[model samples]
Target: MLKNLGTARSIFLVAGFALVMGLLGPMPAGADENCREVSLPDGSVKIICQDDGGDEGSGGPGGGGSGGGERTCEFNESEIACSSEFGVWDGRCYARVASPQPPKSTPVWEGNDDGVILECNPPGCVGGPAPCPDRSFYWSPTAPAAPGPSAEELAQRAVAAMNLTMGEIGSTPPASTSDPNAVGTIGLPIWLWIADRAENTVGPITREESDGGLTVAATGTLERTEWTLTSASGATVGAITCDGPNAAGTPYDGRNSAEPSPTCGFGADLNSSPGSLTLTGTAHWVVEWQGGGQSGQITVPPQSNSTQVRIGELQALLRN
Candidate 1:
């Protein structure tokens, strides 16, 4: 049913699809029922062979297992047509991930270039992992569990690395400002000025699914509120409280009204020292994420995003 046309490297994808559809060969009656594989603990390596002619656990070098223990199989899923024939060679049942592929001159064989190509594809054994080719036999009494944290956990870690902020508060860039009102000085009405929101995402992170094999479902959420850490002379003055960040945010975002902000807007006392005028903004963030059947929440310590403003008395110039 399978035949080579011209060059071995010229294995057409259409031909592979044809074989899968039974266009070139009798579509295996029960498909996956016929994909029999067996492995034995022969030394460090085991034997793996596929027999479509027999029922499940019916054929192979040592016959398929009833327990069907788990094993690692790596393969380039995108290229199913380059199926290399699984053969017993040099003590191992097949070429391992460690064994480099036959050189390019051999023939565009398995993704790694082995010439012995198979005519059919195995059921549910299509893809795995990042991009790489691997399809070797493994022997175990029970399926092996993953060794590290789930994909969601990794995604949460990626999200935490972003260190997001809500721009700067007060002043133009939260630095030295010529306007006394933005600096919270005495006699002038000052309002909380928060910059635009700073948003971030670690992107289309991936995770392994128990059902349809490996599926991508990343998990992470970041929620934050703004508050000013108002202090003076290294002594506690007063806290702005955890007033909902929404009401305390953006006093200068084009609402062109002289209306006084009752939340975070106020004037410093004239008696307050001009020498140590400190206006700071503290952002409280609550991060929560869930993935791979597990969930967690992280309360990041508030720091780093606070801005420093240089306060100087605004002197008025008298003209004659």
Candidate 2:
């Protein structure tokens, strides 16, 4: 049942054959057209060759079927297993990209699988998978790929570097205005100061690739904060500050309190009830990052904390 197949080169070997002992190595070199190799059910290798290259029982060329019967053939592996012998595939191993250039190779599929990818190039076709056609779906397998995964990884690192968390915010108002609860007369000014910041807890976010692994580093700083003050008294229009002041100076105007803040302060006429006025600071943190040959910045949602204040009128003494 041997047929004359053209000189095909790459060889794909299945694993089970190696485990068995009875199977012999490839047949001697001078096999005629009637010669063919077969693996018996017991894992034995045999070559049946005709005295002359004949069409005795060959279905067609290498079809290996008898009595005009047509045996089906198909490809199975999705890729060329890098370690496979240069030639057609035998459907059992993973495909790998061949390297070192100009290595043209042809694939000979041996199964009911048709997903194999084959390539042909130079130096007598000894290596590598073929290049994918243009305008097609391209997936990265250690090949030249666009900035997709790397970009995403860099973005995540930037956020962690900023480390804009709820626990990082604390107050540093003037000493006299430091009281969580304070009573001020009409026409009086309440001073404010920039809240104290916790030292650098996180660093800028960046990406690094080494030893076949990717690592992301994080570090960031706050750019600016948006603040608003709400009053419970007759004043509906509360004071808002967009200006970021470094020093806790409030003109100190004519107030008796120490270090009254002009930037981060609120003045109220009078609250009808207790604990009605509130001063809330919302910090809009901006984090910037660049690494892994890419750079970008992201803004997180506003994180805020509030302080309660009470307003009352001062009683004048009668000098009778």
Per-model RMSD to reference: 17.9, 20.0
lDDT of 2 by residue, 1-320 (tens): 12322222112133445644237654543555555543322334445444434332211111111121212112221112112233222121122333332212321222213333223221123344434221011111232211123433555754654456422222322222466454644445455544443433221233332211223344445444444445666454454444434322233355455433545554443122333456555555555554433456667676666665555556789998
lDDT of each: 0.38, 0.38
lDDT for 12 in candidate 1 is 71
TM-score winner among the candidates? 2
Scanning candidate 2 in windows of ten residues, the lowest lDDT window is 132-141
Number of colliding residue pairs in each model = 2, 25
Superposed Cα deviation of residue 272, candidate 1 (Å): 4.9
TM-score, every prediction: 0.40, 0.42
Candidate 1, residues 265-284: lDDT per residue as tens digits?
A: 54344214344445566555
Task: For candidate 2, give the lDDT.
Answer: 0.38
Error (Å) of candidate 1 at residue 195 is 1.5
Candidate 1 C-alpha error for residue 150, in Å: 2.0
